[model samples]
Structure formats: structure tokens, C-alpha cells
Target: MAHSRGKRRLRTLVRNGWISDQHGAWPMVILPAFVGAQLAHRGSIAATADTLAVIDPVLATSLPITWLTGFLCFTAIERWALTPKKRRPSCLPAIITWGTIATTTGLITVIRSPMLLLWTPVFLPLFVAALWEVLHRRPRSPLARLTTVTAASLMLPVFALGVVGAPSPLRTTPELWRATAILGSYFVGTVPFVRSMIRARSDHRWEHASVLWHLTSAVLILLATIWGAVSWPIGVLWVIIACRAWAFPRWQRAHGPVKPIIIGMLEIVLSIVLSALIILA
Candidate 1:
């Protein structure tokens, strides 16, 4: 019985060490990268039909995979590092394993594409802010959450750089920034929308603020469409997101608390739709 209990406890620790409980964060990390890859594929086709045809399949596949692995490892290490001091000793194995993987993969990626280092200036401050939040135990603060969302959104350009087979500075193209803005706006708006539902559910002000933010996002996207900055499809998607933001809280207020899984599923569907529209448009 003692041996069986010990085995179970070890299994639980290992599982908790490897898997993240922050389910909402996965989409933020993944969707931007997916959008970037699709956009790059599209850009390559537009630039030259033979562009992708000539590129090495291994290279095209490996860069993003390696980068993503390194990124996930880093995040896992960060999560472990943030554990309470008394619990941190138990997290040591996870931290060391993830840290090693993160370092090795990160080095390989940077060596393969040295130009990626150019993003240092962009990411450094955000990293600092994120670290500050972690140290201060304010990871859920609006500023901290926005900082994280912004960092994730910027990965779109990073993935684009890998797929488009170019090393140009991220600022060279307006389209990259524009797409980042569209994606970032949705994620930033999510911070408040989620807070209104869970953490600040009793605060009417959060609901109002969330509605206002979504409406503003929808209007801004509409204006961008009118200005020919983005296509109408993206504008329509923003409007749909805005409606979701407005309607869901009222439903929750009347019906009582909704299951988090249902909320997560709805966001997943919306994220898929958003990614598809962005790519198609």
C-alpha cells in the first residue's frame, strides 16, 4: 500500500509538472502561429507559384516546430518557477528538464535563422514586464495579461518570417502589423471579457467595460475595412465577437453561472472561425 501510494503521488507530480492548468492560454499561443503560417503560405503563392515548391520540406516544418517546442518548454519552466518556495523543491526536476529543452531548441532555432535575433528589442521589454508580474504575483493583473497577449500576438510575425523565407525587419511591412493588431485586439478584449465572467462577475462595471471594449474593437475593425486596411470578412468576424461579448454576460446573469468548459468551447469555435476568416480574407 505504501509503495502504491508513492507511485500515484509521483505520477500526479509529473503530470502536474508537464501539463498546464491555464487552458485559455493555449489558444493565445497557438492561433497566432497558425494564422501566421497560413498568411505566409498565401504570401508565397502570391509572390511566386513555385516558391513553396522549391523550399525544403524539412526546413519548412522544423523551424516552427522547434520554435514552438522551445517556447512551450520555457513557459513550463516559468510556471514551475512561480510555485511557492516550499513547493519549488518538488518542481526542480520539471524545471531542469524543461529548461534544458528550451535552451537547446532555442539555440538551434536562433542559429538557423540569425535574423530572428532582431526581435530581441521587441520582446525584451515584454519579457521584463512579464517577469515583474510573476515576481509580484500579479499575473492576472490587466497590464500583465495584456503584456502576455501582446507577446503571443507578435509570434504571428515570427512564424511569418520562418514561412515566408525572408529576414526582413518586422517593421518593413504594414500588413504584418495590421494583422497583429487585428489578432491582438481580439485577445486583449478577451482579458476583460473573461474577468467579467469569472473574477469580477459581481462587478457590473467589468461587464460594462467589456461590452464597451468589444464594441470599440468592432467599430475599429469596421473603420479599418472602410479604409481598405483589411477585408470585410474580418470586420464581420469582429462584429460577431462583439455580439458574443455583449450577449453572453447577460445570459449568465439571468441563467446563473455557466460551466467554464462551455465558455472555453465557445471561444475555441470563435477562434477557429476568426483564423479561417483571416486566412481566407
Candidate 2:
């Protein structure tokens, strides 16, 4: 019997050492479990944050249970999903995609559903991963093909919703200029970096241009005004970094050095910025 392309590719990857029969396959079970838990944990995460914000904006110290579920969620993904041996094998990004929803649900518990109201962590990381595929890798799995289609449909909308659904704090002017600029900065600035080589296709120029442009674009996004009220610059940028989800695979497929390094640097900067802005804000 002829195997389907997916089975054939998995066979190839397994044979060539691109993947393995490993515990990463646990996501088939773990993902479904997390989705169920998120339904119950959602209210718990929200109520805890809403109630606690009064004592201290920081809420650094709280009852153990208050922080318990969110911490469990975080630790579960960071520990199990990022397991080194399991990282390269199986489909970890999809697992992380689910975790992003889990992260948002848990966070909504604390911030009253408006904190990052418009933002959905699931979009950028996964979309960028797909974009990286468009730019670099070949589609191997049916799910991968489906995800790429889903991503293409959602890319502009993700940024568009992020622009439009920007809350009252982010939209004081009654006009969308601020939000537009903010989204523009994130979109135009980064998209070019992603496509710079493809568009220009130069040798040394791609290297220097990617670094310079990536830094400049990232800083602008971090500092970009969201109607001047929504000032969590670092956190906003940090999500961008976390969503730099495609950088590695793109590098593997394209045999390019610049984009991946630029992507890695942005991921680091955004991660730090997100943590600092959200925590300290």
C-alpha cells in the first residue's frame, strides 16, 4: 500500500534524523487535557486578578491558590513543551499555540478581560511560523497545510483587529490614526524584515540591512503610541518576540543567516520588554 505524503514525510524525517518517535507525541493527549482545564481555570484566573489588584497593583505576593492555576499552566508548558529532546520532534508549535490560548484565558482572570483585550497570542506566533514556511520550508503535514491556510486568512486580520479592537485607553482621539500607526509600525516594519531578502535578494546587504532594520523597527513598535493611554510598550513588543515563531525553521529551509539572527534578537528583546512592561505597568 502506498503511504500518504504525510506518513511518507514522517518516515523520511524519522529516517534522516529530522524527527523521532519520542515523548513530544504526548501533545496528542496533553493538548486535549489543557483545553478542558482552561474552561474551568478561566474564571479562576480572571477572578483572582480582579480581586487582587486592589491591595497592590503589583500583586507580587498572593495566596498560593490565587496564583496556583496560572503558575501550573505556565510551568506545564515551559517544562513539558520546551523539553530539549522533545523540542525538535513531533509538532510542538501546535502545542504552544494551544498554550497561548491557555495563557490568554488565565490572564483574563487577573486583568478583567481588557488587559490585552484585542490581542490573541495564538495569531502571531503561529502565523509567523506559517509565514516562515511560505518564505522557507515546504509544507509536510496536512495539518501544516491547514495551518498555513488558516494563517494566510488571519494575518492581516490579526493586525487589523489588534488595530481596531484597541481599547479605550488605546483610542482616545476618536480616530484610528494612532492605532493605525502602531499597527503599521509592527506590520510594515517587520514584514519588510521578513521579506527583505526575498525582495532585495542581495548578499552582504541583506545581512547588514536586516539587523539595522530589525532593531529600528522593533524599537519603534515598543515606543509607538497607542492613543498615548495604553503604554505597555514592552509587553506589546514582547509578544512580537514570542511570536517570532518561524525564525528557526525559516533559517533551516532558506540557508540564510541574517533573518534568523534578526528574528532571534527580536524574540529576546520582545520577551524582556513584554515581561517588564506587563509586570511593572
Candidate 3:
């Protein structure tokens, strides 16, 4: 009976260590990469008739998959690292397994496209800040959240570079940075909007901050459209989300706390819509 109970306990620890509880982060991880790749593919096709002929089929397919796998493993390790030190010993197996996978996949990706190394300077600071936050057990702090979100959104340009075969000097077009700004702005706004709903639900200050951020995002989007960085259609999409950021908190307060699952599902839909609009634009 003792041995059986010990086995069950070990299994529970392993399960907990391996599975991430950050349900909302999945879209943040995926959408930018997909949008980046799609936009790059479009740009390449427009640039030349023989775009597909030049793309390495294996590298084109494998890079994103490998990068994503490494990222997921790194996320798992981060989660495990956040657990109480006393309990961390129980989670070491899972942590070691994920760490090894992350390192291996990351090495393979960098080796395949050494030009990706150019991004190291941009990403290293963000990684350090994020690591500091995690180590300090403040992973959910606003600064930490923003750091992670910015890094994820910047993957837009990185994935774009990857798709176009990592040119020398790592040149990124205005379109890539424009998409990054749009996506990054939306994600940064979500940090406050989500907090207003759940963590700081009673804090009127967070509500105000959320509304103000959304309005700012709307104005920026409008300006981008006027400057021809984005189309009117993309600007229109921003208006919709800005209105959502304005309305949802009021609705939640009038009724009651919406289930987290509902909030997560709605965010997924919004992310999908945002990605589609950017790609189409």
C-alpha cells in the first residue's frame, strides 16, 4: 500500500509539472508565428514568381515546428521552476526532461539558420528580465507579463525572417514591424484588460487603465492606417477590439464574474480573427 501510494504521488507531481495552467498563453504563443509566416509567404510570392522554388521545403516546414516545440518545453520548465522549492525536488524529472528537449531543439534551430543569431541581442534582455521575474516569483507581475508578451509578439518578425530564408544582415521590411506593432499593442492591452476582469476586478483604477489603453491602441491603429502602414480594414478590426476592451468589463460588473473558460474561449476567437485580418491585409 505504501509503495502504491508513493507511485500515485509521483505520477501526480509529474502531471502537474508537465501541464501548464496558463490557458490564455497558447494563442499568444501561436498566433504571431502563424501570422508572421503567412505574411512572409505572401511577400515572397509578390516579390518573385519563383518564390516556392527557392524555399527549402524541409527547412520551411521543420523550423517553426522545432521552434514551437522548444518554446513549449521552455514554458513547462518555467512553470516547474515557479513551484515551491520544497516541492521542486519532486518535479525535477519533468524539469530535466523538458530542459533537455528545449536545449536540443533550440540548438538545432540555431544551427540550421545561423543568421537567426542576429535576434539574440533583441531577445536576450527580454529573456533575462523574464527569468528574473520567474526567479523572484513574480511571473504574473505586470512588467513580467509585458516582457513575455513583447517577446512573443516580436516573434512575428523572427518567424518572418525564418520563412524568407534568413537573409544576411537580417533585414525586416516595414510590413513586418507594422504587424508586430499591431499584434504587440493588442497583447499589451490585454495585460491590463484581463487584470481588470479577474485579479483587480474591484480596482476601478485598473478598469480605467484598461479603457485608456484600448483607446490609445485605437488611435495608433488609425494613425497607422492613415500613414498606409495598415489598411482601413485592419484599422476597423482594432476599433472592434477597442470597443470590446471598453464594454466587457462593464458587462462583467453588471452581471457577475464571467467564467475564466469563457474569457479564454473568447480571447481565442479574437486572436484567430486578428491573425486572419492581418494576413489578409
Most lDDT-accurate candidate:
3
- Preferred candidate (lDDT higher): 2 or 3: 3
Runs with alpha carbons beyond 4 Å of true place in candidate 1 = 1-16, 44-62, 170-173
TM-score of candidate 2 against the unseen true structure: 0.27
Q: Per-residue alpha-carbon lDDT of model 3 for 1-281, expressed as tens digits? A: 99999888766754556645577887888899888788767774223333333444555766676666556565656766677777767656666776676677567667776777888888899888987887777879887898889888988877777665655323545677778888888888889988988899899888899899989889988998999888998899889988888888899989999887777787788888888888888
Off by over 4 Å in 2: 1-191, 197-200, 203-227, 232-259
C-alpha RMSD for every candidate: 3.9, 14.0, 4.2
How close is every model to the real structure, measured as TM-score? 0.84, 0.27, 0.86
Which candidate's TM-score is highest? 3
Per-residue lDDT of model 2, residues 50-88, tens digit only: 221222222222212222333233323333333455453
TM-score of 1: 0.84
